[model samples]
Target chain A: MNPNRQKVLDATLQLLAQSGLSGAGLNDVIALSGASRGSLYHFFPDGKQQWVAEALQIYAEAFAEGCENAISKAPTVSQGIANVFLFAAKMMKARDFRSGCPVGAVVLDLDCDSEPMRVLCLSIMAQWQHRLAAHLTPLPEAKALALAKMIIACFEGAFMLARLERSTAPLTLAAEQMATLLEAQLATVSRSH
Target chain B: MNPNRQKVLDATLQLLAQSGLSGAGLNDVIALSGASRGSLYHFFPDGKQQWVAEALQIYAEAFAEGCENAISKAPTVSQGIANVFLFAAKMMKARDFRSGCPVGAVVLDLDCDSEPMRVLCLSIMAQWQHRLAAHLTPLPEAKALALAKMIIACFEGAFMLARLERSTAPLTLAAEQMATLLEAQLATVSRSH
Candidate 1:
């Protein structure tokens, strides 16, 4: 049961990264995961929506962890943001530009009226923003939050542009802008001292 | 006949803004447009893909025109970018946050394997970037293009974040960042002169 659940989640993420939520049919999910109808029904009685929530949750947690890890490990906050986007860019190129933000694909493709899914996507994105914000040391709380929101928006938007044009420039260019902003903020902190 | 064609395009854009490419089924298109099966095929002989292409073209051209109009009317390039986002923010809020970038929604939700669709999206985005770049009066060629691309990516990405979180903060924040960058660039150009 554990293996089946994990497999389903992983497959769902993969499918989402490639095509989107509505494009990811249930039959494809079951087929890709190799989970039987009986097991799927038993595990996900609420059906695909339940499975999707689980998958999104797992990915969202991992994304937050990644942000924390990236920030902690980097020498500077700007580099930290750059590292995250560069990693995403590399993954996208490796996938031949077929990959994108799973959260975004779901947000765009799913019915907008579905509050549960929207809330879930929003929370996941908020988790990422908060993780980034926590690392913007020396900046005011408001500034850090604003920068974090902009960074996430730019990077996620950059992913869409990158995948659309099949180029890494959009992501890398946004990262450069982010690094410059961080440097400017750091310089401000230094002047006060 | 002309009204029917216009209605179809309007409906297509509406649906794309709401649910994305795959989610906008043929029946929905027919049902929403109030156009008969005969008219849809008459207006779009190659079916939905062809219809999508037309809708996208109409959007892309209008998007480029908007950039031109915004930049030409604004007091400065930074203000131009801000005007675009502010207008978008108003529309998104008006739509209860259900509205999104039709190009972006399609890009994320559609199969990346579709070369035609990807090209269409890329072209549309490139047009916007180029339009912005052309207005960077004092900035050098390379810098102008880079700045324009980054601005476009950030603004476009901000829309996704805005819709997901159902707030205008991300869009407004990104626009603020763009304005700052533009101011900085202009200052640099002044110093050099």
Candidate 2:
């Protein structure tokens, strides 16, 4: 991506994070990116929807990359799970709760009938789930898959609650609870040996 | 609420369930309720936002009542927890995943700075959490509170994923995972005895 195009996408993401899809207007995108109207039209001739689709794709990849990075840095799958939570909590707090998982917020807004957006969201979530499953394969496939979905749910739910409450308590508590869940899973497997 | 006002509120909710806050417009509400512009404005001078707020309140109460009803029908707290999942799964399937916990959907859309909407959302969630905690009090207060949040998160997250993935697999899997968590908690308590 060119520097100007990257700037426009980045601005779109920040606006979406702060103001949601409907709330983020085209003018806001222009002002945030300092790009001209012609530039925007040149890049995204289809207007807001196209711009949003591109932005969602970018955000999804970045989010997935971050989770992969967290997993790689941790010594065990359980520790990696904890690291994901901590990383998420830090991201939420730093953005003052304005930012949530982009895929999460967009999926809610996208029409399920819209094949393009639907496919985009599914592919993103599937990738993350695959990464999570990879980490958990060392434990148990079924348990790991189940936990991955639950953890994703917890993370999304906590982000919603944290934003609504304008406090980090929900995310912090979610992380702690998830840690408990992960530990319990490990303990169960260990004891069976 | 008057008969006409109640109709409007109910109609708003139906539209919200299908298309969400932004997608459901005043014309849609009027068409659904078969109400005139005069009647809508009479009940909600501030228009869409006012109607959405009231609709959210009504939905919250209805959801809480539904959960309470499910719990009451069960033979034990654990059974009640299972019942909540079963009932939720049924409801989600009935709507084909178009509907979710209304308060959760609204809570996700609300701006943190919108004090009135924020308070309404917080109160609704707190009430649901309180009810869950109340049902689990016979177990352990701390564990109950934690589980209550987890349970709520599971449902919310599962609903979101189910809708995004266009399948009930997430909800079914979430129910199984939640059941496992509950059983784990119960076992830990029993072992300490």
Candidate 3:
């Protein structure tokens, strides 16, 4: 990616995290990226749709990779899930809680105006669910898939609460509860085995 | 309230749930409500801000009340929580999955453009936590509060997933998992006692 184009997408993503799709106007992108209108138009001739789509794809992929790495490296699924929440908390504090998952922000809104973007959001969620379930080895596939759904749902909800309250308490509690849930599942599996 | 005023507020809320804050434009409200521009202004002299605030208050309060009713009528905390999730699932299906919590929709966007509205959202969440905690008798207050927070977080997150996936599977999973967690907590409490 050209430096200017990368800068533009990064800025758009920041805006999307902080203010959502409607807030990532072209002018806001140009201003934040310090890129000229001519440059932005040159890179994203299709305008806001392309900018948002590309930026969200970058963000979602990186997020998925981070979760995968965390899960793959951990000794247990519970710890891996806890580490993911920890990373999310650190990111929130670093951004002063002004940011959230850009994909989540987009999903909360029904007016993303582009069918492809909506599909992208749905695909991102499905990918997250699949990747997380893959790490929960030994669990039946259906159980793993269901657990993965609960984990992601709790995570997204905790992130929203943390942002709204400007405190990471919800994230902390969610992390603990998720750990408990995962441990229970593990215990049940071990007992059965 | 006059029929026209009520119509306008209802329309605004529908738009808020479907498309979020930006999508609930005055023109959209007028068109949906069949209220004239003059009547809209007459009902909401302060315009969109007042309209959104009042509409959200109605929606949030009603939602809270419905949860309270479910909780109060259930045989156990786990069942009560499950009922709340069931109600949420039903609402999503009724709305054809196009609607979500209006408050969640607004919170996802940082550009709500009104400090009071932000404060109102914060208060609404606090009220939910407080009300849910109050229902949790026999548990230590701190534990109750923490559990309440986790429950609300899961509910919001599951609702978002259900909307995006256009399926209630996430909500179903969350409800089941929450019942498990709550049952575990109860077991611990009984053992400690």
Candidate 4:
């Protein structure tokens, strides 16, 4: 809530995106954020792990909100899915593929990390899925969950490819495929209704 | 080729899979591998970057071989696709979700890392896509590439989700979608022939 706390969180999240979790150390946070050690520790007394958790929470919340906006603004669910993919592609391209999903970069590095860290990562991921599925409420509950998860997987997958190959082709292709699937599902639902 | 060289390589990779690139340092490698510092530098004079490149090469080779084996053993391309996903699920489950794609963790953590690291990651990713598409030569080249990249993205993305959520649902769903897509494509090719 404090200005210093917000600055520290944003800096840490940016570091996570750029260099990942391990390198997003407390010193990096202090250096990048220009936040004094006193202010940083005052906000995050538990140090690096605590700082990471807070940063992850902030990023995840913003991501969830963005998904909701994308879903709501698109004319159709298929369009919504495509928009999400396209938006990610544009962002990655602009960043020269140097930036990636903060959550994803951190999550990959979490395999042998602490329990608190794992829980934070898992809960954020689960929250993201729930948010995406919420936009698909028109579909059956079971179907919505499956579809949302698949779409999320494709989104995650697209980013990985785009980052590696330094091209947006993979993301574009994923968008097309997801759009097709969404159209087919929506058609079936419409016919049934 | 040396036993100690192999041990050190394996330990670094395991560290990469678990703690990611930044944390998979010389110290972590030495500790996890129980290989002497002298042996590590002896095998890798250029230090961490060289060691990581060797580990990446090993993982890429194993991954390519796995792809070849899966393609050879399956009766159909669609089934081969499913097998890959199923195998990933099994491996993740066995490891209690502690193990992930070694290449993936490194790739994500690569935004601010060295140029050599990015090249190795990109080359390996590109190689995997080419290998998968090779198994789908029946499809038009463009289509095959698109499909293969999509499948790879799904696989990479699935592991990300599986590790984060500590469940195989994302991977399982991705496998189902990919299998269905592959089956439809193969049917079209058969009809055209």
Best by lDDT: 3
DockQ-better candidate, 2 vs 4:
4
TM-score of each: 0.95, 0.92, 0.97, 0.94
RMSD of 1: 1.7
lDDT of each: 0.83, 0.76, 0.89, 0.84
Which CAPRI level is candidate 3? Answer: medium
Candidate 3 residue pairs in backbone clash: none
Best by DockQ: 1
- What is the Å distance of residue A107 in model 2 from its true position? 1.7
For model 1, name the residue pairs that clash.
A157-B157
Candidate 4 CAPRI level: medium
lDDT of 2 by residue, B1-193 (tens): 6898999998888776655666558898889898999999998999888998899888888888988888888786667777777777777788777766666666655544567877888888878888988887547887787678767876777778877776777777777666676777777887888
Model 2 steric clash pairs:
none
Ranking by lDDT: 3, 4, 1, 2
What are the per-model DockQ values? 0.76, 0.54, 0.74, 0.71
Docking class of 1: medium
Candidate 3 residue lDDT tens string, B1-193: 7998899889999999888888898899989999999998987899888999999999889988999999889999889989999889988999888888889888887553556777888898889999988887767899999999999999999999998898999998899999999889878888898
TM-score of 4: 0.94
- Model 3 Cα displacement at B20 (Å)? 0.7
- Global CA lDDT computed for model 4: 0.84
Question: For all candidates, what are the clash counts?
Answer: 1, 0, 0, 0
